[model samples]
Target chain A: MRVLALESATRTGSLALVDYVGAPLGAPLNGVRQAAPLREITLDASLQHSEKLMPALIEMLGAEFKIETIDLFAVDHGPGSFTGLRVGMALMKGFAFASRASEASGKPLIGVSSLEALAMNGSGLVVPMIDAHRGQVYTAVYEVGAALRDRRKSLWDGRPKLIEPEQAIEPEKWLKYLVEKYGSVPRLEDNQIHARNVAFLAALEFGRGAAATRPGACHRHAPTLFSMTPRYLRAGV
Target chain B: MFILGIETSCDETAAAVLTDQPLRILSNVIASQNEVHEPYGGIVPELASRRHMEKILPVIQEALDKAQIKLSDLEGIAVTVMPGLVGSLLVGLQVAKGMAATLGIPFVGVSHLEGHLQAPLLEHPEVSYPFMALLVSGGHTLLYHVKEFAKYELIGGTRDDAAGEAFDKVAKILGLGYPGGPLIDKLAHQGNPKAIKFPKGKIKDHPFDFSFSGLKTAVANYVKKIEGGITPSLLADLCASFQETVVDDLIGKTVLAAKEKGIKTIIVSGGVACNSRLRAKLPEAFFPSPLLCTDNAAMIAAVGYHSLKKGKTSPWSLNAMANQDVRFC
Candidate 1:
């Protein structure tokens, strides 16, 4: 079974294809970091996501991997870029909808939380930090749940929060936030944007048969998408 | 004819199956992700879109299954494709489009806000045209002069931050919690709304295009001053106070607008519409069904049915939109 995954939660968008055979993707796919159970499609942090996302996906679907043979689909739900999420979700929904339109068997869409995806990159104390404007950040702390044979386990320990830049008690606070919050903190290595983690969570969910499932919501079953904006829960939307 | 409907304008992932000629909901399954969003205090678009993706198929399945209908059992699929979160919007649009094509059923897109505007019909059934409609939600707060099913005259709306957004931000600043509307609604039940007279901004007889940003900031500054720290009761009082002002303005403007337009029927919906306080305070001149006050897929389906009957089906290539100022006609 081939798995088509899309990650638009962050500035560096990613798409990965995984197959039961082996590596789910091939070269000619730009932004592709690692290949295999996880193939990362990286992009410029500043480039237009709409411009390159489809072309790369078509390549992966047509030449790199056979999308027709996929059994399920996966995508990221955000704690990342607002515009990116919209673009990515729209595309994923389009592609998935197209598949269903052809009288093909419907593939349940898998949604992995972006925060959880960031946590999957194997850090003992992983902080999946997304930049919220001002001197604040959206963060969820995690303890590695399980480690991949080749990669690291992306997991978190507690609920996410929108805290002042100074509130990040972890390491260097990305340094950028350090000076804004405190006088000066030693610079720590910037975390390489692990875009593939989005697909990994989807693959992980598929491994556990968690596709097309609903996450618990307060107040009468959460009422669908109208109540799902994480930022709405933050100090402000 | 039986119809399936999909609504993904903002945050709620909704699917409702209903009848066309006579509007009636068969199965309405809405999958909400409020808690996943609770911690952050505001919707993370990425999170919301992901939740939509996860819930879209199941919501459709449940709606269809509840109605005891398969894809082929339906005659048409109606979806909302306008005026919403582009990402969240796409999930519902693409899903509905796909279903229509697969089921060999025609599908059409409905305006997300217009769905709420028409919600009064589901309850009143006899609501006449040329009525006054005030739509309040997290994404929008507007006053419209409704002359017919498809004709609306823009009268007033918030200059900054929708009424619902104001409630959410105020509630959060007061540490009320994730969704401020309902919490504020609950707390307002105990507090004296008249205790604090929050500002009801008037644009000098403009009669339309309301302003809540001033009120929102007013409450924020007031709360910061009174307790010197955000507290529950203070938050509750702020909610009550702010709610009253909004209600006063909404009801006042709506009543006057109704009188001027020679129509009588004030309808409300959106996340903020779910507020019980406003529901009780909206006055008898408006829609009374509390259920009709909140956003739901039934309204979307109803609007979609109207579109279908009018042969206003969107081409399969139709794109999801994010702007509220949409002109489908």
Candidate 2:
């Protein structure tokens, strides 16, 4: 089973594949996690993509990794880059749905939060923040308890707000939100989250059955790609 | 099944086949109309579009045969629809749609620019997203932060004529004929790039935006002053001077963009991307594979693979997008 994952919501994005030795990924075969091997490329604005993604997949399948057997696909729904979100999600949904249809009716597909995954493997309180423009950021807070098997994913009850430097709450808001929402308390003071940390959380959640129960997690079928929208925290501010 | 991709965005009429289980390209055929347009200095879209319709079907047939596949074996169809000449784009889109409809399969409309960006990996197979790309074509000049596969940010773009357009215009002014880049490039090697004190429009602080109009006009005015007594050596000098300015502007903005964003990889593409000067002067810090240039359906088809891998399929309404219709300038 070949499990290919795509995360394209940040400046330094990542792609991973979980290779299981079988007809498809997750079908009771030996498996191992591998980063989808990416060749270094010079990127420019007008260098249109229509050819970018599929070739790499083809290369993988042809030489070493076979794709017809990709049993599970993991995609990162973003709190990072907006265009990446639309492009990546559109592609992810398409692939997942295709895989799900071809599956033997028992397999499930899913969407993973890029930020959450980036925060998962962290050593301390994971405060994942993605630049949200206009001096704002898309951020989430998470804190672990000792190590894996005892970790937690924090939630917020209120609407995700865009706070400026002046309106920003003290770092304690992470703990405050956790306490108010999940009623769990954090033990850390200042801990910054990185991408790998987010990826780790995503992996853990998928492993522990904490995420999407179906492929093409999006409930909507039609996604527009030609529009460029500015994702901001403050609405009509 | 065989998937034939037809692309005639500018000077190139390209056809490629996506075949078999892994969707590997069997035959990638591109018949560049650069020479035909070179005498005109710049591609006249009307002529280009007309030529595309004339040669498109043959190119398709050639690709199908080269791939050792037949139309009967083709399951679906794909064509580049947008961000290019409406006239040129229609030729490919119409052909693909016609073929698909006739064959009773789904038609996938691809963005032409996406085709260029996705070209290199057809053979190399290692290129992926989270990189930067500079698409420099006769009709377009822009910078994109390829934040992910098939996802692009319009970080910077040409405010006026694209790099290739400027090359053609400058080449014509110097009496070097049309499709000016190769001519200018060859002439540049014969003359000194520093011969003319041409200006490189430094939109200092614009970050990624570029403007080559001023330089193009400067070279034209220089030629006008010569009053038709254009010397061969002088033309070479002028071509070198103009080419130098264009290359500087392109490389400067691209390198600066990569540096500012801390992006490590940068790929320069498009017909103008095939320019020798740009191929030489583009700062090596960003682009390591300097030859990963040129406009081909191979890239578009490769990009198609990434889009599919990322799961980016289009509905029937997704038409070929024009440059004006694209998200960013």
Candidate 3:
């Protein structure tokens, strides 16, 4: 199965295509958790996600891959740039819905938290932080080590969970929460989220069957074409 | 040929379907967010974009459904991609691009200003080219000498606040709430336009240029100086006076531009073109329907249809420009 993942929760938005080995009929395939990405393209959009994303993704896929080959669509939803998330979600929804005209059923859409995706960039206890403007950061804490004792258990089968929910808060408070959770804080440089990391985490989610669930745990939600909306945490007054 | 147009440049999430050979509009649906932003007394950009994200998909689907066409029937897709809120523009543009790609059809990014330019053509297909166009809207106020399709020369424009924006601001000063254009227009009918005299702003030696910031300030000062502090009666006079000043400047400058360019035919478009005063004053000029006067996608698709015929299609790399001069294209 192939998953087309989009990450536009920040200025630097990107899309990736990851292929997963389907489970055998009798027994689960039980492949390694972090499968290598097949193709990944990162966009240094500088807040130009809507204009640069579609063209970049089409060029990245080229003519070799058909649109039907995409079994799942994923996006790094919310807690980042509000416009960025909307553009990414709209593109994902459009692709998912339009492709349904030809296939037996529409492809599944997977939305992952940008903060959590950032934490997946490295091993060990991770506290991902994104500059959310207004002198605050959109931060979340995650324990992304190989928590599962069995290697056959997928990493995204809900093993590594979010230690703290994502929220926009002051730097001092964010640091305090991180310190309280994990004895000491990790380096600030390690918490940076990348588009490639978004693809990698989405691949884990797809392999774990979390993509098929209606509403999974760990801030992951599968959205239909009509019900999809960006996770705008800072939405009202 | 069938085309789909999506417009989210501002508060209106609009979508339309147009067929070719005569450029007939099959469907035009708009989901306006006026009520959502009414409490603020003006459009809030962030709030506007948020509403666009929520309504864009359903709006497009409804447009297709109303046209009695399926997604596969569309030969092309057009979206307003410039000269408005970037966040709002992105929502429509990205979706159009994705749909076009999925359907294996071509999609083009139409300029918002160009969409205004072509709006008259939708209703007045018999109208020819080489005419002066007065585009007055919340975000823009300009005069253009359009020689032909894709040939636009900007002659005059507002120096400060756009004409419609000034109306909105002045209306707020009188407690008229958000979108002062229609309300002020209604009240101006009851009160005498000559009740209070307001200065018409014009630059020295620049006959076609306009400045409404001073006029807006003058209204603000007058309202503050009134002995009773702006009663309903006083508000009516103020709306009438302010509307008169704006309408005179707009008509006066546009007439001068037309005469100077030696063009007899004039076209008025955009949101402010729906004003009763302008409509009554410029009977000769072609004005789009009241529905088309505000932002809509039918005009965008109309312009896109012609643009695509001319072999002009924006690539997927087309970025949304917030402040692009219409003449440069």
Best by TM-score: 3
TM-score of each: 0.62, 0.53, 0.91
lDDT of 1 by residue, B216-327 (tens): 8888788667746656666567778888888777778877877877775667656666767666776565553555455568888888777778887776556666775733
Model 1 chain B weakest lDDT span, ten residues long: B95-104
lDDT tens digits, residue span B1-329, model 3: 99999999989999999998788899999999989888876679999888887788789889989999888788889999888988889888888877777778888998999999999989998889899999999988899999999899989888899999998898888887778899999998878788899999979988888899999999988888888466677778788888988988898889888898899989999999989998998888899999999999999999889988888888877777788875655
Which portions of model 2 show Cα errors greater than 4 Å? A1-237, B19-24, B32-50, B102-104, B226-228, B283-294, B317-321
**What's model 1's lDDT at A73?**
63
Error of 3 at A36 (Å): 2.3
Winning model by lDDT: 3
- State the DockQ, from 0 to 1, for candidate 3: 0.54
DockQ for all models, in order?
Answer: 0.08, 0.01, 0.54
Candidate 1 residue lDDT tens string, A100-162: 533434554556666666655544445556665566555554544333222431322122222
Assess candidate 2 and give its lDDT.
Answer: 0.57
List CA RMSD, all candidates.
Answer: 10.9, 18.8, 3.3
Ordering by DockQ: 3, 1, 2
Per-residue lDDT tens digits for candidate 2, residues B1-329, read 55666677666788888864555778778888876665554567766755664566567768877989766576556667776766577556645543453344555667777776665445444555666788887778878888875577887888888888888777777666776777888888888888999887756677688888998888878877886697888877887888888888788888878788898777877777667778767545233233335555655665555555455556533444556544434
Candidate 2 local Cα displacement, residue A99, angstroms: 29
In order, what lDDT does every prediction score? 0.64, 0.57, 0.81
